[model samples]
Target: MKEYSIREDDLTGEAIAALLRLHLSEMHQWSPVCSVHAMPIERLRAPDVTFYTAWDGDRLAACGALKQLDARHGELKSMRADPAYRGQGAGRAMLDHLLGVARARGYTRVSLETGRPEPFLPARRLYEANGFRECAPFGDYVADDFSICMTREL
Candidate 1:
């Protein structure tokens, strides 16, 4: 099995920034600007959020974030696998790391908002495989044509 060095990250460096930019660009392309729920770097830096990255040696393979919503709830954010590193396990690695952190933090539930477009199918599949199921809108999110809300209980 392949092992990746996944850890809480500082969200610095050019590679990380480029990955984030590409993530946002793709999100905007598939969904209306208003329906885009992907967080900006600034929002990911909020005190309630913890960001992480999966590294394949010196390369930034992927990144994701867990945002605290309440005492026992969290929201997944900004999960993206670098295009250059696609087909690798970086996205799954980052996700498992984030879920581990959430479990350690005693989060009883974790939720996310993603697009309903074709581009988001792989992500939806990943989440579903990890036990997240389509659910009603969570946190400040509302049900909409372009939005797909999912949640899982710890």
Candidate 2:
């Protein structure tokens, strides 16, 4: 298997910024403006969030984040695999990395909100494969047709 290096990233590089924009653009396209839950680069920079990026040599393969909600909870945020890197295990690698970080940080649970549209099915499937199960809205989220919430115990 091809190797990837995943590490905590500062999100300041041009490539990383572009990837984040792509993630947000795709989310906005699939859901209404108000329903788009992907965080912007600014929000991802908050002190409570740890963002990461995966690289295969010089190429940016994927990115994701773990945001502490409290002492025992964290939320997965802004997971995205570059189009060219899809099916190359980039998404799984990023998810596993973030989950490990959450566990190391003492989080007993991790949850996320993702779009409910057809374009998001693969993402939901990925989370399910990693043990996430459907749940009611979490954090500040409320029930919405455009969103689906999932959670998993660490």
Candidate 3:
């Protein structure tokens, strides 16, 4: 498989729409608390949220977001690797790239909320492999039985 490159400029309107569609079609059912599942593409764009997209050659392979919660804290949002690229390390690469961006932006802590179902095992494992540990819910997320929260201190 080809190695992917993460680029800030790749996060465009069309790319965001594609990502949203992929998330809705495949990953929405994977999470009970995924509010963005049916959200409009335009709504995903905001000043507080910065997005990144991974590219394999000219193809968009994955995308993720970093929402600045505070000067030293950020939240992971909309992390989705395309179905065609699953199990090819694109998801891990995107997470690493997002973390690097968060650290560069002076964020001391980063956290995420994902489902706790069996289908979400790989996602939790990926977060753990990247230094994220189980933590109490942050941001607007509450302590949900169907959701698992993870945080990493940079």
Candidate 4:
């Protein structure tokens, strides 16, 4: 496998924009419009969020973000691996990078919200494999059949 490098993204590159568009498209496909919680580029650029892009040399392999919920908690947002790079460790690399950022920020816990449909099984498995456990909704999320929330302690 090619070496993957993760970097904080400014969300200004064309490749980044294209990847985000693809991420939102996939999210909408797997979940109802009302249930889709993937953030747009503008939201990912907000003061409390940090966006990252992973590269396999010159190719963008994945992207993800972490949003500070409070001094001790953070939320994972918009985690998506490029279709061409899926199952190639890019998602794991991105997840690890974001979690490291959360730890560096002094967060004691990190959580994420994702669709509950079959299309999301792989993502759920990835999180579960990384020490995240299903939990009650956190942040502004609610208990709904279409959404599942998971959290991990730093």
The C-alpha lDDT values of all candidates are: 0.89, 0.92, 0.79, 0.92
Q: Predictions ranked by TM-score, top down?
A: 2, 4, 1, 3
Runs off by more than 4 Å, candidate 2: none
What are the TM-scores, per candidate, against the unseen true structure?
Answer: 0.96, 0.97, 0.87, 0.97
Q: Candidate 1: where is the Cα deviation over 4 Å?
A: none
| TM-score result, candidate 1 | 0.96
Q: Please state the error at residue 61 of candidate 2 in Å.
A: 0.3
Model 3: per-residue Cα lDDT over 39-60, one tens digit each:
3445457788877888888888
Q: For candidate 3, what is the lDDT?
A: 0.79
In model 1, the Cα lDDT at residue 45 comes to 84
* Weakest 10 consecutive residues of candidate 3 by summed lDDT: 33-42
lDDT of 4 by residue, 1-154 (tens): 5568999999999999999999898888888878889999999999999999999888999999999999999999989999999999999999999999998989999999987788999999999999999999988898988999999999
Candidate 2 lDDT, 50-100, residue by residue in tens: 999999998999999999999999999999999999988999999999988
Clash number for every model? 0, 0, 0, 0
Better model by TM-score, 1 or 3? 1
Error of 2 at 112 (Å): 0.4
